[model samples]
Target: MTPNDPIDKGDLLNVIKWAIIGIVAIAIVLAAMAGFGQLNVNNVITLLTILAIALPIYYFVMMLRSSKVTKVERSRVKAYIPLFFAAAIFWGIEESGSVVLALFAEQRTVLHIGSWHFAAANFQSLNPLFIMILTPVFVWLWEHWKKQPSAPGKFSAGLVFAGLSYMWMALPGMLFGTSGRVSPFWLVGSWFIVEIAEMLISPIGLSITTKLAPNAFRSQMMSMWFMADATGQAINAQIVKFYSTDTEVQYFLAIGLVSVVFGIIMFILVKKINTLMEGIH
Candidate 1:
């Protein structure tokens, strides 16, 4: 397909529809596997390894098929460097915190809910439940706010709320002492906070990429965003490995500190970046 192919709103809608379908399909498969006792940790690891092998092959095919590949000018891309780094930091800390929470907080404690032994890992899904309930309210409020002159500032305020989510874990660490039994609610609460931060940053980042990338290379630019995420995941694995020796309090504190700092930096830069983006658009 040529870069100048007419942009169809329907195509975008279809892509989104298919993506949701794929997610539901995968979820169903995973649920079935879990029910069948085939979705253990080893199986999940093996599936990830397979995808790791497959991703490069898919990228190579895309590279081969496209002829309009013009190098994205470093000067242009460099303007987004701060946002990219912020994104990487956010992703890395969120991922690493999940590992630390699971390993130190969740695994160390077990809840016997009647006849079932509920692993702390299962509680991690609570964030999705919260998102399902809160997303519509958030969207409605966002739309209403957008009608006001000060909407951007109001929107950026969400970042502060997101940053405060880290304190949920921090306060508990201080109170109960990180080594002792703690409620699983903290992880869910932290996830809910980060989810808000995610709502603020991620869509804006994608919109920025859509605007900043050269028209011909927009798909490649979006792919690079995913690659950045993969890079963060690799770095997260390293962080988890390196900090394995540290106490739960130490790891959570470090991750929370990084997140809070990154959130503040991003919030400070958002207005400037918004102006720069206006110039580009």
Candidate 2:
């Protein structure tokens, strides 16, 4: 904002006001979805309710407190949005695919690792478990690299890995026809690929905001980082509405193709995007 364009107190208040309105609107839509049998889980509603309350409160405060943007900084901030958005979309689809994976997982069986066995009910933690084990090794590998992808390139690579994760699942869904449970190893394999993608994306995500964000809009850009993920998950919610046992195979194939296609495009265009970023990597 220019010096002449003073921050109106009412305008600032209005931002918070509209934030509440948007949250309430989403809450209503979620409530309606739950009412209509689209979503019926207490845990999901509780998470949404907490997000409805907490996210706006955090951002409203940030909006009030953040400094004004300069024209150059504004341009930089604009450049990062698409990059963050691309990474966020990867997160959305890959993570959302987990829910679909579970829809096909064996409910009555157990999964084995080494000497240990786990019931299907505990399979949800597999991703995090993979993440915890792999992170240090990945971090070490990253540290040893002489040349690295630009921030945009790293994000693109993550997208490709994410797409590959779904493609792996698509193979089984295609072969198994969703009529009976596939081996738990399919779930294990899919989770393994995603956790690898997360390792690539998550570290880059944590760093790029600081590297790329405008001084005036640092916090706001970070907020955008989060919003990108939220937007992707919102898309996932809609996608989930169409998924079922019968459609599982095709669902994985379609999304996998979309992600991989976009990822290839992103990989091809990474240098151009990085050039547009003006050395933010």
Candidate 3:
């Protein structure tokens, strides 16, 4: 491949830098949480503040090193903005699904297999653990698969996987009912499934955004990519009210079905979307 044919070396470096930043930041945050043996408002607040400051500085440095883009490239970027927009909502749903699990997981109050009692944010912390275990598995599968999926196909499948994760919870809710404590494995399974969806969405979403992005707005497009996360979560805040013990099954089914349907739609339209993308995948 030529220097700019597959991907520009500089942009690839920027992606590598941010990917490292994210991984290292998650590791540090999880390490800090582990040191305290749990999460609390104080540590979370502090870490989040540090992250907010640190991420922008990193982005700023990269932006300073970036060159300007062309007019044709700018026009191409505008058309691709919708890709990021859709990704954001799907990302939001994925996030909101975790919050739902955390809400119910805390309610159980005890895990008989261990001495540990349920704590606020305790279930939420399992995300990093699962990510560690499952990431390489996902990477191997994606890399070794007979055929590769386009960006739209992967993104759409991610949404469906997220929906499937919610549906995974609905099974226990339907079978065991929500009256009292059930099993920890239910939450475990849901987290595992969703993180698979993350493997599909998060990194790929970043890559697609940059590849499809206009030259002038390369870095800006990356920034906009995260907006999908915020947008999905914000929507989550509003709709999450619908999730509770009594409504748990319904909520899971609703989100799950919606995600699956959209995934199908995107799959059907993947060819059209790919055409619009020109060469980005």
Per-residue CA lDDT of model 3 for 1-281, tens digit only, reads 23233457897998899799989978887888888786776556556555544554454444444566454454446445445545755776667645766677777424555775656476777778878988888789878986889887887888788878878878987887878888788877888888888888888887887786655556566786775666566556667867778898898888888877877877787887777676666
- Clashes per candidate (backbone, < 3 Å): 0, 0, 2
Better of 1 and 3 by TM-score: 3
Encode model 2's per-residue lDDT on 154-253: one tens digit a residue. Answer: 7777777788888887776577565655567777888888788788777778688777666655666677677767756766766776777777767777
Taking the tens digit of each residue's C-alpha lDDT, what string does model 1 give over 131-171?
Answer: 68777876787678745322233234444554466556567
Which prediction has the highest TM-score against the true structure?
Answer: 2
| Candidate 3 off by > 4 Å | 1-82, 108-110, 114-120
* Model 3 weakest lDDT span, ten residues long: 56-65
Residue 235, candidate 2: alpha-carbon lDDT: 62
| Number of clashing residue pairs, candidate 1 | 0
lDDT of 2: 0.70
Output the TM-score of candidate 2.
Answer: 0.76
Ranking by lDDT: 3, 2, 1
Which segments of candidate 2 are over 4 A away from where they belong? 1-11, 14-67, 107-117
| CA lDDT of every candidate | 0.59, 0.70, 0.71
